[model samples]
Target: MGTFQIEGGHQLKGSIQPQGAKNEALQILCAVLLTPEKVVIDNIPDIVDVNKLINILSNLGVKIQKLGKGKYSFKSDALQLEYLESEQFKKEGGGLRGSIMIVGPLLARFGKGYIPRPGGDKIGRRRLDTHFEGMIKLGAKFRYNKEERFYGVEAPEGLKGTFMLLDEASVTGTANIVMAAVMAEGETTIYNAACEPYLQQLCKMLNKMGAKISGIGSNMLKIEGVKALNGCEHSVLPDMIEIGSWIGLAAMTKSEITIKNVSWEDLGLIPATFRKLGITVEKRGDDIFIPAHTEGYEIETFIDGSFMTISDAPWPGFTPDLLSIVLVVATQAKGEVLIHQKMFESRLFFVDKLIDMGAKIILCDPHRATVIGHNFKSTLKATTMTSPDIRAGISLLIAALSAKGTSTIHNIEQIDRGYENIDERLRAIGAKIIRTA
Candidate 1:
């Protein structure tokens, strides 16, 4: 495992660009299986999970060609439908939750699909019940093998559309079902579905490939099944998680930074939430500019004039994935803010590390915490840290960068799983960070 040695107290100035959205890129790459024609994707992120998915695709005979920087052309023709059981495929595709999505297109085109249990961040109990349930509703039969931990599906007569409502607002579940329904026999209506931007982008791309979809941005999606999907070029949106990371990085370091190519319209409630903590985000055209200084930005209290609390919720609410970074940034702010991570229970456990660094934080159970901003006083003490999860790892890096001295962060391979060239990009912004084993 590699480690990151960071020297702190550096004010990061200058600009940096974010890579393509990781969530969107995964879904788009899986969608290539829907067609045998060449599909070109631009702005691909050089992250670990993406590379793993690419290997899975290549194992299944999907021709992946890297044409240029952040650009790839993929052709799913000559795919080996039975290659899922090969040792190479099992090792690479076994635990990636994104790989299970290939089942939808495989069953649609080849009458059968096999998938091992998909693996991803063990943040919480993520079940594939919804994906299989949606496929069942579309007239597919599924069987599970306990010994192999694999799922096999067969749709000999092909999938036929049916109206169904998801049990929860599962993002991958919704994407899998939507892909299968697009090639079904008739119209399919999905209610209580996740309407995140990534799913919306997938729908838009599928529509461009001759699929008719209604209610694009709403909870209810109506898909009129098409016979097949053809190749189309689509650009993935900027990762909102990366954008939030930048926002936190600037506030913690007290640096002036500008994020370009950001979709301001899609940033629902992010600006307002950060504004509550006294961080000024200036919007000039499509780019967002953060001012250099943050001396007097008071953390806003509640409407009844109580300590302010920011919580995560579904779409149109503050995202849970960013609450960790926000919490770290709040530590250096002026006043107090309560952070509530409602979705995952154990996410806030890392607050102990921040507390050890001299931040005033109270762990009030697993779901909530009260943070008192330090006003950049009693500078954080350097120490060795280990990454617990993807977002938390990045937050730890930001905190270390703003600390008073040098700190070592181990298990950097976990950090590389998400952020693309994070050290190099941070270095560009005048941060003193280096990657070493």
Candidate 2:
């Protein structure tokens, strides 16, 4: 395990570029399996999860070449289908949630898909029913091995497109179904699909590769199956979650930082959510400039004079990924706000760590917490803590950076799973953080 020792109470200043969207990259990377031609992807973040997916691809006999930094070419001309049934594949594919996405494309192209129970952040019960049920709707025979904890799908008669109203708008599930439908026979209509920028970009990229998809930014998507998909080039958008995390860090530590090339149009409701907490965000071209909060910031109450509630929903709503950062920032805001993490029950439990750092927080339930801002009146006392997940790890890092004295955070590998070179990037902008093994 690695640890980060952060010396807090420093004002960071400078500009940093956000890594390419990790979520989008996962979907895009998995999309490469839809075609046998070379798919060149740019702006791919150098993170652990992405690298693991790439390694899985390589293990499956997909030809991979690193063109440059954040650039790669993948050609699945000789995919080893037998690898999917191998114990080695089980070990590799079971390590990351993104690995589950390969099932859709593999089933679409090769008539079979197999996956062990995938793992990711232990935030909530992320069921795979949406993914499997969506595929089954498209005429695939689904089977599960209870003893092995494995899922298998096969469409020997080939997939035929059909209309499906998903039980919920699951991002990965939607991406999986779309990839499977792209090569199926006839037209497929997906209602209540996830419309996040990640899925939007996936659709756009698929279209570039000869798939006909409509409704780029809406909850409903129409796909006209194509005989084949060719390779195409794609560049991922900036990581909005990381962008929001930087904003929260700047606010809590009173730092002035500029996040470059953020694709402002795609960051729906993210900036506004931070603004509700009284953070100043200026848009200069494609960049979001966050000025230092020297005069302190206040949380805005609802018009009805009730505590402002920050919650998560599907796209166009405050992302559940960044709610931890918002909760941390609220610990230093001038007023109290309720954080309702609707998506994940255990996500808000991290508030206990923040409370231990001398912040006033009330954990109302597994999914709700009320944060009363300390307003810089009581400086956070640095202490040792273990990071629980990706977003929570970064939130704790932000809290550590804003606290008085030094703080030690173990289990930093959780942070590295998503954020690319986080310690190096933050250090360039005056954050006093060191990574030690």
Candidate 3:
């Protein structure tokens, strides 16, 4: 296992660039399978989960070439369709949650797609029902192998588009269904569709590939199915989650940090959400400049004088991914805030480590925690902990950076699955973090 040994109590300076969206990369890379022409993608984040998906594409016989840093050219002119049935494929595909997305394009183009149970952060129940159900609504047959925990979708006679009201606006589920429906016969209408920037980029890219899709940034999408799609160049947006993490890090460590090229227009509720916690998120020409919180920030209560409650919801609300960072930043603020992580039950479980470091936090339940800010009256004392998931790992790292002593974090691979060269990037900005194998 890899580890990060960090010396706390350092103030970071200089500007750092946010990496390309990891979630978007997974969806965009899979769309290459929809066409046989060359699809060139730029700004691909160098992260573990994305690299695993790229490897899976390679194993499935997509010709890939690295043109430059974060740039690749892919051609799916010839693919090894039988690889989907191999044991090697099953084991490889199961290692990544993003692998579930590949099935959609494969089914649309090759008439069949199969995958064993996929794995990722052990946060909660991340069911595949939404993904498979969307495809099934488009006239695909679904099968599950109970013994192997495998899922399959087949549409040998081609898919026919139809209207679907998604059970939930699951981002990946909406993305998978859209990829499959792009080439189906007639039209496909999806209501309650996820309109996160990740999905928006995918839809735009599909449109560039000659697929007719509308309702770019809304809860409903209309698609006029085309017979086929062509390859197109696409670039990913900067990861908003990482951008939010840096904002939290700056607040916790009293550091002045500038996040560059953030594509401000697409950051729907992120900046305003952080400002509600009393963090200063200044918008400066598409760059976010977070000044050092030399004076510790205060939590803003409701107009009626109740404690502030920060919660997650579908897009246009606070993202569930950044709730962990918000919870950590709240620990050092001047007032109390209730963190309701409604999406994942166990994401709030990491607060115990912060409590051990002398932060005041009350774990209300599996999905909620109340954090009482120390207001910098007491400095946290660092200790050892293990990373449970990507967001929690980064939150703990931010805590350790603002603490009083040295700290060690094990299982940093979870952190690497999202953030690219996190230790190196943080070090460049004056953070005392080292990665040891």
Candidate 4:
């Protein structure tokens, strides 16, 4: 396993261009199976999950040609759906939670789809019921084999669009059902769907491919099924998660960083959420600048003027994926803030690690914690740490980079699953980080 050795207490300055949205790229890649024509995608992140999905598609006879950096043209004219049942499927499926998306396109195109249990962060119980329930609502039958621990779905009469409301706002669930519904027989109306920026991009791309979708930015969607779809070129939007990470990193390290090419319009409530912590972000054209060396920052209380409580929720709300980063940044700020990770039960477990490093934090329960800032403490003791998930790994990296001495973070493969070339980018901004095997 690779590990990161970081020499802490150095301010990182300079500019960083955020990578493409990992969530969008995954769905767009699987959407290639919706047609037999050639599709070109630009600004794809070279992350581990995307690379693994590419290998899975290649093994299935999809001709993948890498045009250049962050650019690729894919032709799946000879795609073999049977590869979905191979050992490679198991490996890829176990590595990515988004692999479940293939079940929709494969079923829509080939009349059958097979998928094993998907893998991702162990933050909480990620439900697959939403995906299967929506598929079944659209005239599909499912059979689960206990021995193989896989799910198989078949649509004999073709997919019939139905009015279905998801129980929860699931990101992958919304993508899978939306893909399947686009090729169905009639109009599909999905209520309570997840309409994040990534989902909006997918809907836009599908519309370009001849699907009629309305209410693009709302929780409700109307998809008019099409007979067939042709491939098109699509560029992914900037990753909002990466943008949030940079915001937290710059604030904690007291560094001046300019993030370029940011989609300011898509950043709903993020700036306001960060402002509650007294971090002032400046915007110049399409770029965002975080100042170095904040004078005196304190947490702002709620609108009721009570204690400040930051939690995660559905789209247009603070993201659960970023709560970990916020917790680390809170440790470096001047006052205390309550973090409520409502979506996941286990996401707050990493706060204990920060507490051990001379930061003041109280873990109230599995869902909440109170973090008191380090008050510019010059020394945070370094220790050997293992990454539990992608976001948590990045949080630890932020902590390690701002600590007093050298710290080693193992299981860096988890970090690479999301952030692209973090060490190289950090080094460009004067961060002292080295990769060792």
Instruction: For each candidate in the order shown, give its overall lDDT on alpha carbons.
Output: 0.87, 0.95, 0.94, 0.88
Q: Which residue window of length 10 is worst by lDDT in model 1? A: 292-301
Expressed as tens digits, the lDDT of each residue in 376-436 for candidate 2 is 9998889999999999999999999999999999999999999999999999999999999
What are the TM-scores, per candidate, against the unseen true structure?
Answer: 0.97, 0.99, 0.99, 0.98
Candidate 2 residue 329 C-alpha distance from true site, Å: 0.2
lDDT measured at residue 262 in model 2 versus the true structure, 0 to 100: 94
Provide the lowest-lDDT 10-residue window in model 2: 345-354
Of the pair 1 and 4, which is ahead by TM-score? Answer: 4
Off by over 4 Å in 3: none
Model 1: lDDT to the true structure: 0.87
Native-to-model Cα distance after best TM-score fit, residue 162 in candidate 1, in Å: 0.9
Residues 83-135, candidate 3: write the lDDT tens digits. 99999988999999999999989888888899999999999988888899999
Candidate 1 matches the true fold with a TM-score of 0.97
The CA lDDT at 380 in model 1 is: 73
Q: Relative to the unseen true structure, what is the C-alpha lDDT of residue 342 in candidate 4, on a scale of 0 to 100?
A: 94
**In candidate 4, which residue ranges exceed 4 Å CA deviation?**
294-296, 377-379
| TM-score of model 3 (CA atoms) | 0.99
**For candidate 1, lDDT tens digit of each residue in 43-160?**
8889998888998898889999998888999998899876887766777787577898888878777777888887877676678999999999999999999997888888999989
Candidate 1 positional error at 108, Å:
2.2
Model 4 residue 152 distance off true place after TM-score fit, in angstroms: 1.1
